[model samples]
Target: MIDQEDVAALLGTEGPFARELPNFAPRAAQQSMARAVQHAITERETLIAEAGTGTGKTFAYLVPALLSGERVIVSTGTKALQDQLYFRDLPRVRSVLDARLKMALLKGRSNYLCLYRLDQTVREGATFDRTQASQLATIRTWSARTRRGDRAELAEVPEESPLWPRVTSTPENCLGVECPFYDDCHVIKARREAQEADLVVVNHHLLFADLALKQEGFGEILPGASAFILDEAHQIPELAGQFFSQSISARQLTDLAQDSLSECNGVTGAIGLVLEPVEAMQDAVRRLRLAMDALPERGPFHQLEAKREIGDALHDLREVLAALTDVLASQAERSRGFANAHERAALISERLDRIAERDSERDVRWYELFPRGFALHATPLDLAAPLRAMREQTQAAWIYTSATLSVSSSFDHFARQLGLEDPQTLQVESPFDYAKQALCYLPSGLPDPSARDYTDRVIEAVLPVLHASHGRAFLLFTSHRALRRAAELLQERVPWPLFVQGSAPRHRLLEEFRHSGHGVLLGAASFWEGVDVAGEALSVVVIDKLPFASPDDPVLQARLEALEQSGINPFMGWQVPSAVIALKQGAGRLIRDVHDRGVLVLCDPRLTTKGYGRLFLNSLPAMPRTKELANVQAFFDDEVSAPA
Candidate 1:
């Protein structure tokens, strides 16, 4: 029998924590969230929660999930957390509760090492140079010893190695059970573990990919769990939008073409059927890349722009792909690999034609160009219908929780966006003493955020604060260009271990930052959220400007235009709330633990000057605000001088 009283006691102050450790103190907010989640699971209702930082929301949800006797599938935002959940937190909780449970962690296909692809690439002699040959040799050695066949186990092989794709599988290229090496597939083994588990943890990408699989009648993970718990749930609308959209990229096409050619080489009649079309597709991809190179840096292009000169190129490429599809169709039945390739080519051809046609009223069609390639996309303006359909189709309870899910403690923005109907929302504030833990510092007399010299001025303003904090600061920027500019200007001026994003991997940078004793890490959007640091190592968080989603982005523009058509104020309805949630995330970095003390510096003057600025301020934790550098220095001084 499951015990509710025991659940309450474990979450209470004088319960397991109080009995186990002298330093343990229970959080009421965490207990409240636990009760709510338990209630949701009991009633099988769709629920939303905005549990702030330090609420111990993970355990709050996990404890109830374990006790409820419901098979729960917990979805996180990243794979790093997915592994952490399975390897660390879940085991800790199980031990704490002394409950026996079977749990599994499942990531997407690409994370696993494909034995089939690895064997084919190495045995067929795909390497062209000595460096690649050496890399293949290293992988071969690792594969023999590795039990799980996870590529992450190979630390010596650099992340940027081109040989990784050859050893991994994509959805389009994976031959699935049809492959000769199906019995030994790493991905399949992982999925089988997940299917047999009482509880499974997955990332957001895998969750949506599974949802798509269910919709399309394919094998997937986490469909039959009794309850679904989404941590970092604010990302749902955006992630759902992506999965619901029709997208086909040049990279996917290129990879498919290359893999098809590689897989079909030895088969009879493969040369004429595969070689000619693969070469043509490769040429077309190069042409598209070359043509798009003339366009500006990565940004959205309208249908008219796509249809002009670039439109002709898309048409020509689609025709070539179409011809390839015809060639593959006749020979596909002979080989499972070639058949999958044919299906992918046909889908790509249809989507390209649809993207070029741009005739769907319900869908907003656009394309983005990268330096090397581009992708065409069609997103539904509203995801509510489909999202609601998904909720109805599944018998499981849906619980969405995140630190930044609310606008002014209301979940309407999040709920309406995802089409959840009357979701029971509970906003649990962080138990941390925010007033004592953090200070919001706005630099006085700074130019607008869009000014060309704004980064320089922000750096100039932050110099004094950085000095006070003794180089333990995160200089977070909105764009890479801004991060580069600020890093260039500050690295020479600051006498600290300066770690810039992309210098090393994100985790490595964070790890070094913590170990450095004193280091200033400059990073962009990725660092702004999902970063957790506590205590003296991080004394300040300085953001160059308020993180407003770029207006030039295709999704933002589409959303704005869609709102305008309906005569809703886009700025209030879309822009302001969205920016507020992001700003809250950036500011949230300052106060992680109850003992954490820092100044959150938003150098943008718009917080005080603009009419919509209060929304951002109102959304953040209610902390003391200041516009002076002296106050920040004094705050740090008082903390340093204070008794431990």
Candidate 2:
């Protein structure tokens, strides 16, 4: 293993950044990270680590990954991190290491332009408006000089533009080797680079998709990697479930119908020939919509008795898809121009077939009708089998690291979920003085999270903390409905500026909150993790509940039912540990740095009322705990007065 002193000396000599660089020298935690990577490379054993926020973990892993002289794939939880690694961190490290290592950043195919589709669109000359025509011309000009063909370069293209599908290929729409522009396909080009690169940066979804062979072109990732490093590994279990599942949306069918109509009219002058299938799909969508419309607006899906009607519509839709597939397949080889269109139709039909196949026990299938349209989802109750298969096939040192992997300092919960047995694990606590830096306040008398006054009580409990912290706070909720309600109530009651999740994109909301420096940001799910706001811009984290998955949630219900049939205690087996991990993630948003100070106010009162509550407390940082609201106010007041 490389000596820390020696590595530090080499880093200093590398001169990637000037002496006056703003970042601090790599700290002790970073050194530990380096040693761990070196050990993993030398001894091919799976390792789990918990590196805290201030650890400078990116460089800690990257330095050794670059130095090891072996192929490596680093997977992150979010696209933001992917961009940071590919655009910023990798270049700096490569410059400093002076190693001629080939590095490639591969995102999901959606991020790349589909050359074949773009060519077809250009030829058809379809335009929504004069402005859209101008945009298409601009895109055509940009495509000529784009070496990587990444769509991210076209900053002006709105994601919702109808032209996107015409310019980009889905897995179903891709022609693979048969594509006329296969050699120039941006996704293919990116994969070719990944295949040859020493280091590959990818997001968890892409990595899982590759591992599951769900991706169109690639069969797997990490074929040559000596090690696979997963950052934000806590998200893997859920992401694995998603990747291993199948989903077909009504909007997708409708879009296919619309696209087919447009292509037939624009390209082949055969709109009449395509009208039957298009109208069939439209009629199926209308019947499903009408069935859903008869049901109550909001309730558990199981409560609605319209399942039989919805099932009939689904069956009818499947037949329509089959007919469309036959029509397209019959004409696919007839013309070069319609080949992509035909392939798309075939793909949609196959997906519909997958949805149509009825499985009694292995998968949980459901339909959800949102405001826009309905979607059919089929999810495996357990992803353990596929995840284990990937683990075995890779045959490399795997390290899954994150701030919130353990519950009550035990890896048993997460390990069992991922189907890893007796894996070597380490729980490195954050080295900050949490007792002095933060407080965990649990208000006493709030109703259970399901009650009508739950959101109101939570808002009331957090108002004092927000005022004490002077609006630099995060109001994190587990449910979107609860979050919106809290945000509304708080907006009316609190004097500070308020930022809600749906008002803007998450990154934009964070930017606004940080810039305002006098607002309380309310968000759910994503905001609880992968968010980093240091200093006084964020001081208080108010959690509305214990962050438990609802018992009625279809996925959770399915998993729990499975556990019950297997003679396992569903609450202990699944709910308690998961909520503990989630609560820790919510609490973690506070005190991100050694100098950072803040308070975590959990208003659920379950922490005091339930026996499992103690487990949640044990999983949290060893911060000073108080049940009194006045103490929290005083701590915030003192910290504000004495600081800086």
Candidate 3:
């Protein structure tokens, strides 16, 4: 068994990792983090671990997890990271330790191919464009030979292809044991394997879905785990809010209508009764979407109901959904499909009533519009109590680790958010010599981020630094509008190849940027973190503004109001700390590896002008601060002339 002492030795310079792996330099912070994780797992207690960049945090937790002789569920922030951990990091550690343990990777059901759905699609002979038909054909061929049925295995199909919905299953549509393909169901197989595995890798979506018992037909996987190690754990609070919230979407309504019609093909006379109500529900959904066109993209539900046309449209939708539910209920006995449709309709109707007509002090009633759809949500203002309850119910060690979990070097905000009361905590700083490896450049005399000319002036300021670094820089913005403006402004001014976020897929854009070696990449929200560009490929990172959540956001607005009602300064208590964490994530992009040398430019004048800005600066890794443009140019010059 791997004890606390063994945890340190195993990661030591002369240990198995050093002998078996290449370029395995021992990091004290990594070893310390491993020991803390091992201790937490052994005691079965909750731990909040903050492992900074270059801390080898992945290996730190993995070493202890693989050797703990316990069933572990490791949840990552995204599917990409989940894959990297399972396929890349886990194998390396398992091989080095020679630990005999079964491991499996499980994703949300949408990621897996539903054999029954595919068969139905093929039999129904649904009309499709030539491109979709070709994609369907390709999926058909791949499904036959694939073991996992994970859509990720087939690269020929784009992730956003509409055909995927037809081929994959959702909890509502999956027929469970009654499914003809139950024995060959990919999602079931994945969960079964996860149940038997000693270690399971899942993204936050799957983890929360299972915890909420939202993924029906499968036994709960989280409660059975001996330990839950949530990496990129900072995302949990927001994700937990989403999972715990009640939501109804236009897509769900459309799916229910379409699925009811699809089921009619199996039962004689079913189409006669189901078709009209289903079509009516579809039309009602369209009408609601159109009515919402006059509203903002997103706002409080009261604002939505305030408009007479929107209120009427919502009423029509509720009535049509109720009509469909009754129609499906009348036809429920004919077939299993009808029964499922009936259940889905009744549930959706109930949800629609709750979201549209109900009021709750605990929940934020909000509506958001998409291009052709909308979602009504009732998100809870307080997740702490429920999160605490879930943690206690599992009786498992909970390990939450992230580089940016703390603000101003304190975990109070994070702990309170999750209802963690005095849990064990660890903050292992980065092993990198930040003072020597990087520079923090706060550009002088910049307008407030709210100024109309802020983005323009930010571009004007960053151009010289980009030239100094020979165009290898990331200009990250807090909003899409700023990113677009910066992209347009930089196109004519910069001579380097430009890689804008929306111009290509993120992966493709990052690939092109890395290959360009001197490319200037402009991006927004998604680019703030989870991007790794080591070496000279990225030497400058310019953040256009502080990443404060917009007060205009309905959820944030509600939560802030609640805080104010309770006599807390919402801006200091909630907004500032959250923004500090976000800024840390953005600044972290500059120095990813120990050898990486770069300059981080903060164009938001608030960093120096605002009192709370000190918290953001203090939270970042200690590095030299400068306001002179010459200093940035000289830093790059020193890097270029340094020893090879």
Highest TM-score, which number?
3
lDDT of 3: 0.91
CA shift of 570, model 1, Å: 0.6
Off by over 4 Å in 1: 1-5, 17-24, 128-134, 298-307
Q: How would you encode candidate 2's per-residue C-alpha lDDT over 228-315 as one tens digit per residue?
A: 9899999998898788777777777787777666656544646666788779878887877777776544343343334788667667
Backbone clashes in each candidate structure, one number apiece? 0, 0, 0
Best candidate, lDDT: 3
In model 1, how large is the Cα lDDT of residue 595?
77
| RMSD of each predicted structure | 2.0, 3.3, 1.4
TM-score of 2: 0.91
Give me the overall lDDT of model 2: 0.78
Candidate 1 residue 524 Cα shift, in angstroms, is: 0.9
- Model 2 misplacement above 4 A: 1-22, 119-146, 154-163, 177-183, 214-218, 265-269, 294-307, 336-347
Ranking by lDDT: 3, 1, 2
Instruction: Flag clash pairs in model 1.
Output: none
Count steric clashes of candidate 1. Answer: 0
TM-score of each: 0.96, 0.91, 0.98
